[model samples]
Target: MMLREVNTQGETKSGEMIAEMIIECIKEAGHENVVQVVTDNASNCVKACALISAKFPTILWTPCVVHTLNLALKNICAPVHNPRSNEDVYDACYWIKSISEDVTWIKNFIMNHGMRLVMFT
Candidate 1:
């Protein structure tokens, strides 16, 4: 269950607030029923996990695997390196770029054609 809906009008979310919110949710859901907490790999979220671990040592806090996988893919697709000379540096994986472009083109093609989109769906 969602504990709170963060809004743009309020103060920026802090580690403490996030921890408290998670604790509240765990309590509401029955602490015994919750084996672990999965959260995104944001710095605030990681800090919140630390806070949670400090308060409840038995409960495990883990980063979302999907987020971790996406980060890995992003790093592999777009690598950063220092260029030795004054030239453009494109270190992205060619195969990954080609696949991504093909997927994008397919999506655009399907979206542009009503019948093709219906058939694809």
Candidate 2:
């Protein structure tokens, strides 16, 4: 379903084609009991959702939770960072995520901060 990025071997078409493909797959399946199709909140996914809704008429198409989290993170931090600065928001997010995933580092941080850790952010 990942239709982005391709070589000159005619591997893909425009974004619209991806949308059409989703619809085609649903129709091809011939299943009348489909409930929903969950997708990321990308523009292409939006287009695909629209197409599927128009065709299915009864099925719900919604954004994935992971994509929503990424969008929320971007919206909350993108404006606070300087676009011209070398310190990118994405890098900061990755650093925070990486450190949080490390149990020892998190325990040390929590121990150093004590009760103040709750208000550290």
Candidate 3:
């Protein structure tokens, strides 16, 4: 189940609870049957993995390869002069999320375009 944070005057589940739910999912999925839990590189996701590691002690929480690459790219592509710029991080994260969100279609389009190029040649 997804998690939602409640405001001071509101009520909702917290990130910690979300992490616990993710661990519960791993448990419900069964220890021997599951191989990995791949997720984004958000802070909450990281915390979730930590919770899994601490509680489960068996299931592997694999950070997505694409997410790792995005992190590496973020560090490398950060503005040289503006080290503390949030805009750069936001733009990079937005594009990365977009690409991952529609990865299957993007791959298909690239393949189709590549075939068309071969036909033209």
Candidate 4:
């Protein structure tokens, strides 16, 4: 559950700033009530989690698995605009490209049709 949303739209999101925001949320939620903190493995987030862990020894810090896997998939499914090198990598792992295309088609098919989208929802 999200405790609160802070409007830090233009603020610099350094590790320290991120840590302070997370710490505030944790304090508001009650430190003892928070057993774990999960965040994506960005440099700032990693540093923030480290700071939070140091401050609250009892709280476990874990990298977000979904975010990690999405990072891995990004290279295969959505690489930079270098077709030759990307095609070479995709050829080596053909199934990855095929599955990604299939998934995109499936998503579009479902989303384009209101009836289909409603069924899933």
User: Highest lDDT among the candidates is held by which one?
Assistant: 4
Can you write out model 2's per-residue Cα lDDT over 23-110, one digit (the tens) per residue?
6666665538567788887787788788778778887988999779756555545545545544465666655454434744766787
lDDT of 1 by residue, 23-75 (tens): 99888888887789899999999999999989888889989997897675555
Minimal lDDT window, size 10, model 1: 81-90
Global lDDT scores for all candidate models: 0.75, 0.65, 0.65, 0.83
Per-model TM-score versus the true fold:
0.63, 0.51, 0.48, 0.69
The TM-score that candidate 1 achieves is: 0.63
In terms of lDDT, model 3 sits at 0.65
Superposed on all Cα atoms, the candidates' RMSDs to the truth, in angstroms, are 7.0, 12.8, 11.4, 5.2
List candidate 2 stretches off by more than 4 Å: 1-15, 74-121
Candidate 4 residue 69 C-alpha distance from true site, Å: 1.0
TM-score of 3: 0.48
lDDT of 3 by residue, 1-121 (tens): 3232233345344558657667666667676766667778777777877877777677788878987886665554554545666775666566665455486577679877857566544
Off by over 4 Å in 3: 1-14, 74-121
Query: Model 4: how far is 118 from its true place, Å?
Result: 16
